[model samples]
Target chain A: MPVRVAVDAMGGDHAPGVVVEGALEAVAEAGDRLAVLLVGREAEIRAEVENRGGAEDDRLRVVDAPEVIGMGEAATEALKRKPDSSIHRGIGAVKAGRADAFASAGNTGAVMAAALFGLGRLPGVLRPALPGYLPTPTGTCVLLDVGANVEVRPEHLVQFARMGAVFGEFFLDREDPTVGLVNVGEEPGKGTDTVKEVYEALRALGDRGAIHFVGNVEGRDILRHGADVCVCDGFVGNVVLKLAESVSTILPDLVRAEIGRQGLGADHARTVGGVLRGMLAPFDYQAHGGVPMLGIDGTVVIGHGGSTARAIRQMVLSAARLVEQNLTSRIARALADDDAPPHP
Target chain B: MPVRVAVDAMGGDHAPGVVVEGALEAVAEAGDRLAVLLVGREAEIRAEVENRGGAEDDRLRVVDAPEVIGMGEAATEALKRKPDSSIHRGIGAVKAGRADAFASAGNTGAVMAAALFGLGRLPGVLRPALPGYLPTPTGTCVLLDVGANVEVRPEHLVQFARMGAVFGEFFLDREDPTVGLVNVGEEPGKGTDTVKEVYEALRALGDRGAIHFVGNVEGRDILRHGADVCVCDGFVGNVVLKLAESVSTILPDLVRAEIGRQGLGADHARTVGGVLRGMLAPFDYQAHGGVPMLGIDGTVVIGHGGSTARAIRQMVLSAARLVEQNLTSRIARALADDDAPPHP
Candidate 1:
């Protein structure tokens, strides 16, 4: 009855070492409720698993993958050429019903392609979205299409909102998540023609109790977490995500240097620096491993290329939680209900 | 002859008090090189100016404006109805050649409308952009059309890039400022159709030695000051601007809270907080008083609604600097040159 998560052991920056370590950690921490399928070069992954003190019980398994998708290679190209890649094999396991979910710290494009091609998109879901959780000054908020669908239509945005709402309900435990369309301004007539149309659609959807729509939210609101779910085209969402990460990295370092120049005591300076670092550290996607490709037939979490043991552990844990909560099923049901016409 | 700047004394959140204080500060700091024409309710401004401990010096004068523009009113409506409003009067003074520039911390829309109507746009300049100096992680960079020209064409974007370049040269003192179009990606075929066309135009302009065109830059590059000037439609630019401000405000608070819970000394915490605050403080546009509306016939700096005395002082100083730099003339020359067809 343990939630089984298939992890691409050869897919991340830290590779077998971090993936193995993370799997062990997840299994240990999750007790008997979590199982991990380490899919990679059999001999290498086996050695790594043994190095990490071996699996606690039958809750762990090793699936061999002959190849890997490089971080720099085009994701779609790599998926076609490298069918035996660990990321591909891992996703296959989930689709084949060998694993409940799949997690990878590999190329995002490859993971998305593999998930869509391997498992397929759910009903009424035109495109899958990479939904990311950003910690804001007020609280944490979810942003969809962080990098998944680059060119999206009004209908795509509607689906993203629905998927994001479902994810938030399962993860953040928010009842009737307040959904907001990320726009240039809060005004109704702001942004491009696509945004305007989407705004109208979202407004209509909200009126019918599909979701608790909060209307349009500006860029600053992305970090403010003014709404539980924030939906935008992948281009905008990706930009927002990258910018927030860059700011988190650069601003704190600048602040620390400035503070150090002021001749603050070493102990105090380090403590303050530590505090600032912790506050910003979460923004680094490596810590969260990867983003989840929502609206797919099965749960798939994409990790960053530079993910480490801790990040991988978090990814595994996230995957298990997604499966346990039956997030995909809930999202599919919502989409189905949305597609159905209203009765008078 | 000292550069004269008209101040809308009755505008902004801390109006009259802050505006008067800032004007006096600018006059005192700039010595005889600058003069301020404070336009507002004559009695209120005089009382505030008198309370500032400086006598009615030769460099400072007050003009009577019976009405004031409210921040909530639409810009076009406010400008059309309140002809004798403080902002309108200040702009009128510039039009009448009584002042070299006009500065206001009133409603941005109103100030923009008044400037366009009174001062008029320069030749070859389709729209006047509101450019602000955003303090990035690397250094300060210029972001154009933060809220000006919301619906922009490819031609408008080219103009924005040119205007931003001029701004960088005048304020940042860059000899050959590098200009970039803010897009979702750095690839040649990234972003929406609008951005792609602008990219091609910029490339063509860059080849002619008009400006150092740096191709496309993502949101992360904004705070990095990757280029001297960052150009985008008003919507995207405004989003970036507001997001940066929000991050600047929230990041410090998060750090402070963490440090506080750790029971760090107040002085040490303040030191850390101060550094974080300082990095973000420059973005407090109100602190700097006003931002110049580049490419206009005369100088115009739009201040924040929450402007204080210090902000007004900074705005006054900025206005004087713009006059000293001959920003408007330089912008006109650049625009004329840019509009010319390339040589074989």
Candidate 2:
């Protein structure tokens, strides 16, 4: 059976239009193995789908969601107020077995709230983390708690490491993913007390074959691909993500301007832009469509509130892949074992 | 009435060679307005200084110090053992009223340790902070505690903000330096409890017209001249510094490589390198020689351990500038009456 992905069609920056286009492209690329459920104002989505001259096939379906959660609204508040919102309805589809996984480029907080409230968390999972993939010279690395949990305890970091490990193993297909505690330095005594404790815990866990712990790594190490999973508090993770994004944005522009002065002409400029974009594109989470709220019982990927149609489509494609890979269940199984002792 | 600076002749990566050359350049540039005391092994320094074939003047003096501090040696331990080290001797000259300020491209920890032990901290300064000037598109911004105190409290952050504000006002000559707390987001309730408390404290302090507090700014804001003085704990500050350096290094290479593929010749490549280097070079703190340890009673600037003679010379020039500006005393005066209520 093909993997079914439920997308909140009315959500994101270019909702319905970009989302529909992205879905068409995703379906075409995914062949017959993927199915998309565009859950939003059915008439509008149907009109857009039909206007594009793409035939309605068994792999594509339109489900109605009358309401929408605004990007500016609080996640929990929006979820409670707008129960019939497109994102909520889409998650409900996953819960009701109509779709295998749900993805939405709506309010992140709302999607997270809906996923946790609707699908619930996995056993032994204290909090669901937003693990983002950072592209490095070697390959892609994961940085957990990109913005999901504001205040995470030391135990939360430990759990994030575990879940992130599973993500790298499944998504990026790495064996024994190297995990590192993101700190100021590589020294054991470096960073806040919370990080220090987490470092010890991670080391102990690694000894038991939970993950390949690489000890403390610095910010430079994140881009150097020093570790497969970089674990930190939500605050630090968010800072790192934003910093990387800013650098990626500014550096390319500076380079382009510098190159333009030499009269390399249009062809050279476009080539440089394309190469820079390809290198930095992975950091743009919008292009990835959504960030997976890992460690939940069911598959849920939360997209950026400012996401466009292409972003929404990517979210749908990612959700479908997560379902096919059985990522959630695999993460749950990894955390269920309680044989390891707590490190002092 | 002219400012005098003591340069550690036997310090840094390319010591004696680069240091000797840079000092000659500094002395020649300043002319009769500045006096530079070269502190190291008298014979070697004098030989290097004389070999440069410059007119002999009373403005430049070679102070004898038989010992040298190895960059790899433990900071405090090295200082304790080598009482006659060039860095220690240079500070002694400042304490003894022979030089206004001391600059060295030696061990940073040793410089801090020596500054504290030799020169002492200002009246209410809890700890001396290493303040780094980061170049931005708008201009330059000062970030304090780049690598001074690892474990910091809310109170420490408050003090750093104060010191950085004073430094900015005096050195950068900003009338009211806008101080910003570097956090994950601009939202009031976004960061960790520590950051939240610091934010409130900064707000309270800013309300009193003591400093222009710009509330919370994100990581991206750091490089955009968002605030005149961006304050954070040493751990976070160090991360920011290292990340900036890594990006400056990696991005140019990536750009050059991509441009090379378009058959851009060696001349064009060199031109690209020159332009990018000019823009990114200012952000490389290592090239700037050393960072000043603000809040100390006397002037102490710690240069990179791998700093060459060029860096050492720059450190000497920077130290002279700080002394002329009366950086330490000015910061002390500003922080003297800061008894405002702690932020909630």
Candidate 3:
């Protein structure tokens, strides 16, 4: 059977327009390997699809989800208020096995809540986490608990480490992925009491070859790809994710201002800007698709709210890939295997 | 009397050489307004001073401190291990009223420990916090406690807010600077219990005109200069500081690689690199001098370990300014005046 991705056509800033376009692009590219179920208001999505020269293939179809969740609505409350919301319905499609995976750029909390309620957590999973991919000069780094559990214990972090490793190995297609605990200092004894315990646990896990643990990595290490997977409490991880994203826009603006100051002429400035933009391509959040909500029973990817058509397409394809790889079950097995005494 | 800044000549990565050179530069620029007491091994300091073509003014003097603390030494233990170390003696000079302020580019923990042991905390101050000046496109943003308190209660954060405000207003020359609490999200109740409590307390204080509290700011707001002062528990703040510092180097390297890929000629690449560097000048930690360890009884400035002579000079001058402005007492008064029950 083809991997079917349920795209939230009413989610994100541009909503139906970009979402429909992106889904079409994904279906066209994936051929027989992928199918898409655009979940949102049927009329709007269909019009958007027709406007984009229409999807000529049968792999693409619309699943009507009338209720649309606003970005500002509180998650749990919104999920209750709008059961047929695109975010809820999209994930529900996955829950019903009508679609292999779900993807949305809507209210993150709502999507997470709906996923937790509908698909439920994988067996033995303590908490589901949001992981964002950070682009480094060497390669991509996976940072987990981006905004899932603001205050997490050592156990939650350890689970994130295992899940992140699985994501890196399967999704990113990497060898034995290295995990690093984000700390204020690089030393083993550094950080809060919770982090200290986490260090010991992750280190113990590393020794047994459950996951490749590289010990403590400071914030500077995140962008440098100091480790394949960087784990931290959701508070710090969320802060770091947003901070890293700002660099792409902020740095380019700084350069452009300087170019103007130097009177570098229009031609030279354009060339310089083009080169900088090309370099920052990897840093673009929209192009990379959705970040995964790991530990869920089924595939769920959350893209940037400001996602372009390109980002939406990437999110659909990425969701399809995660379903094919059976990331959810892999995570469940990893957690269960780690349940044995780490010291033994 | 001239504001006397006791410089730790035997501290920092460069040590006596750059320290001596920076002191000379500061003294020269300040003329009779500032005096620098270089504390280190007498012979090494004198040679460095001579190597810099000697100091012609009596404003510069060398204070012999035979013991030198290594960068890797434990903070509290190192202070006891090296009684006559430059870091200890420099702060000792301030404690003994021989100098108005103390500045070091050595081990941060050692400097903080030394300052705490020697000068002690200011009246009404629960913990001494370190604040770093971040270069924003608009103006500098003060972030604290960079590495002081890893875990803090709501009360400690309130104290940080007051202290950071004082630093912003007095040292940064801002008019009633706005303070923001860094969190995962921008909403009032969007973080851990500690942060939520902090938000309510700060809001109350803002209403009472204790300090200009601008509500919660996300990490992306940091570089955007969302607030004049950004406050967080040191764990997150330290990570943010390190992450922000990495941008100058990482972004440049990315651009250079892209330039190579685009096959831009050496001359064009050089021009682009130069422009990028010029724009990134404010991001340079060395140029901005030392970050202040606030809530201490006396002025204490902590410079980067990798500080160059220019950075050292800036640190010395910054120290002198802090002394001249009586920043220590100002912080004390800010905290003391805030003793009234916030709600009442």
Which portions of model 3 miss their true places by more than 4 Å? Answer: A53-58, A338-344, B53-58, B338-344
User: Across residues B1-344, which tens digit of lDDT does each residue of candidate 2 receive?
Assistant: 66788888888777877888888887877777678888999988888877888544588888999999987677778988999999889999999999998888776777888889998889888888888777776677888878788778888899899888888886577899899988977878667788899888888898888789998879877877779899988877887777766776676656665566556677655555565675675666645677789888898877876676566667777788888777877887877774653223
Q: Which residue runs of candidate 1 sit more than 4 Å off their true CA positions? A: A41-47, A50-58, A186-197, A277-287, A338-344, B50-58, B265-287, B338-344
- Cα error of candidate 2 at position B46, Å: 4.9
* Model 1 pairs in collision: A289-A303, A290-A302, A290-A303, B18-B309, B22-B313
lDDT (Cα, tens digit) per residue for candidate 1, span A86-136: 988898899889999999887777888889988998987888888877777
Per candidate, chain B TM-score? 0.94, 0.92, 0.96
Query: How many residue pairs clash in model 3?
Result: 0
| Residue-wise C-alpha lDDT for candidate 3, range A205-318, written one tens digit per residue | 888888899999997878888899999989999999998888787877788789888989887888888888898887877667897899999889999988999999999998
Give me the TM-scores for chain A across all models, comma-separated: 0.94, 0.91, 0.96
Cα error, residue A344 of model 2, in Å, equals 5.8
In model 3 chain B, the worst 10-residue window by lDDT is B335-344
TM-score of chain B of 2: 0.92
By lDDT, the candidates rank as 3, 1, 2
Model 2: what is its DockQ? 0.42
Structure candidate 2, residue pairs in collision = A18-A309, A19-A309, B18-B309, B19-B309
lDDT of 1 at B272: 68
Models ranked on TM-score: 3, 1, 2
The local lDDT score (0 to 100) that residue A6 gets in candidate 2 is 88
Question: Which prediction has the highest DockQ against the true structure?
Answer: 3
Q: Which ten residues in a row have the lowest lDDT in candidate 1 chain A?
A: A335-344
